[model samples]
Target: MSGPSPAPAASDGITPLQQMVASCSGAILTSLFVTPLDVVKIRLQAQENPFPKGKSFVYCNGLMDHICVCENGNTKAWYKAPSHFNGTMDAFVKIVRHEGIKALWSGLPPTLVMAVPATVIYFTCYDQLCAVLRVRMGDWAQEAPLLAGAIARVGSSTMISPLELIRTKLQSQKQSYRELTDCIRAAVQSEGWLSLWRGLGPTLLRDVPFSAMYWYNYEKSKSWLCERYNTKEPTLAVAFISGAVSGSIASTVTLPFDVVKTRRQLELGELQAKNLSYQVSSSTFSVMSRIVAQGGFGGLFAGFLPRLIRVVPACAVMISTYEFGKAFFRKHNQERLRGPLQTRNT
Candidate 1:
């Protein structure tokens, strides 16, 4: 029998630009698959006390009573219904049944706009920062991925938050600004341009630690998998499993912050606009307190299952594609450069 195939070189000749391109492509493709879950997660997170209601029809106007869980057409209190998704699969079915298949992709525009560039910047910085630290710290470079991921995520968040704010609002049932410009204009007119950064604080809280944990776990898991499986280059299955495990762990640890972030981004200003009562505070601490008071500790994990499911697969796809893309590009680019030299030698 032929000898086992040689292990592929790890990140050999993988330039920062190539890393970025690979990451961006992976993230965009992932977003397409997972945006529906994102929509459901946002809706679940945006649920608040005394939910909104309006617009009712008798013969199932694309919405079922159970699907819109909170608001019942027969309630005689409001025109619209509250969302009542059972879980991830239920959310998918309900959204498609009631709102049509297209509804699953709500806010996709802002998602892509934010995610593609954010991913590019994050991966590029991660690679460069790891390189610098690896040279300086030797073994300590193992921790570099964690710090680099966190720092890169925070840096990208400044730009990504505004788009996220818009997307959250668009995805939320509380308001429907059909156009991206409409959302921006409305926020500017109502809350000033600064409003676009509404949840930056909580976003940072969720993202920084999340990024650190995710990258750290991902790196460690990758190393462990390779060693356990007796492979140098991780197969796609190995990469996907490692990423899924890492993402699930990180997501679970950081879920409470995500709930707070979504609420702060989507509900705070809307409540203010409608003159509704909310024990509002600028601090995430106080917001967390309010959520706890409202729904007990369990409320902190409003969309935990869906978020976990979405993140696991999304992370798997993104990480695997990123690794594969880097490998492909690196090999192709080296071969291209070598061709000219080989011809000269011949």
Candidate 2:
């Protein structure tokens, strides 16, 4: 009998190009789905003053121009819209009714622009770094995901931080800038170039730890689920569940830093909007202390509910979509290789 045909060469799992494509797709979908939640969350977290009910005020969040009635004392939005949101559900209803549905997607343009590249860099780097570190660490490979996730987050967050600053400004503003460039020009002229990177320090503090925890938990959860299900690779369900659990835990733990980051960025945006020369403090701890003094310890956890709600689904959708996309490309590549090999055998 003829010797068994040589085993087919193992296909490289997924190329960086494939990873980028997958990550881009996931980012766009996640932004579209979660932006409304984000808008409400920011509005809640950034509101320092209360609006009395039935007060009509001019609302200009992103491109929206409307007169909104504040139904609750707690309602606020980008540009001090009079429609006061009492909570997450209230914010959703008021924003939709007063500003129209499109207002829910305020800041979507900047978010998409920022998210696509950021997610691509973040996810692809994490995957590549994990692979490299796992091999290099040998017996210590189990810790690779934690280090790789943190490193990837630091790199990606630093690169896209300017965009993040812009996005937050767009989302939180109550006034209409003629265009995005107008906002950028105003900020640069007033605050100088370094203004673009405002809040980056708090961003890194929040994100690096969140990334490390998220990836560590996600890997462990995915592995356990896969083993339980007798699957060699993670399924969409596995990815979704793992991501949701990991994201919820990380988001909760890192929320206080998120609150600080929002306050810092919003202070800058407000200063730029009003053409004020006053300097805002950049100390994260200072902000935290002020928050505690103002709202008590509860202040540090502002918007916790909406944030948790947003993060759970956002993580599930983004990660599952990314994994599915990567799996698709991997299968396509393997099939392409198989076709040539089979033809050669014949």
Q: What lDDT does each candidate get?
A: 0.66, 0.72
Candidate 2's TM-score? 0.76
* Pairs in steric clash, model 1: 53-80, 54-79, 54-80, 55-79, 62-98, 69-83, 69-84, 70-82, 71-82
When summed lDDT is taken over every stretch of 10 residues in candidate 1, the lowest stretch is 57-66
What's the TM for model 1? 0.72
Clashes of each: 9, 4
Model 2 spans with C-alpha error above 4 angstroms: 1-12, 38-106, 165-196, 278-280
Please provide, for model 2 over 1-346, each residue's C-alpha lDDT reduced to its tens digit, 9 standing for 90 to 100: 0011111112246888898999889988887787776667556644645445433332222111122334343444343444556887887887788878888777576446666888899998998888777767878877778998999999998888776655555544444656777878888999899888866788798889989999888888887887788776679999999999999999999989878876765555455454565465669999999999999999999979866777788888898998889879888988998999999999
Residue lDDT tens for model 1, 34-118: 7666566544444323344422111111100001222322354321224676666776777777778877766465446666887
Candidate 1: where is the Cα deviation over 4 Å? 1-11, 38-103, 162-198, 272-279
lDDT of 2 at 191: 86
Q: Which pairs clash inside model 2?
A: 75-84, 75-85, 79-173, 79-174
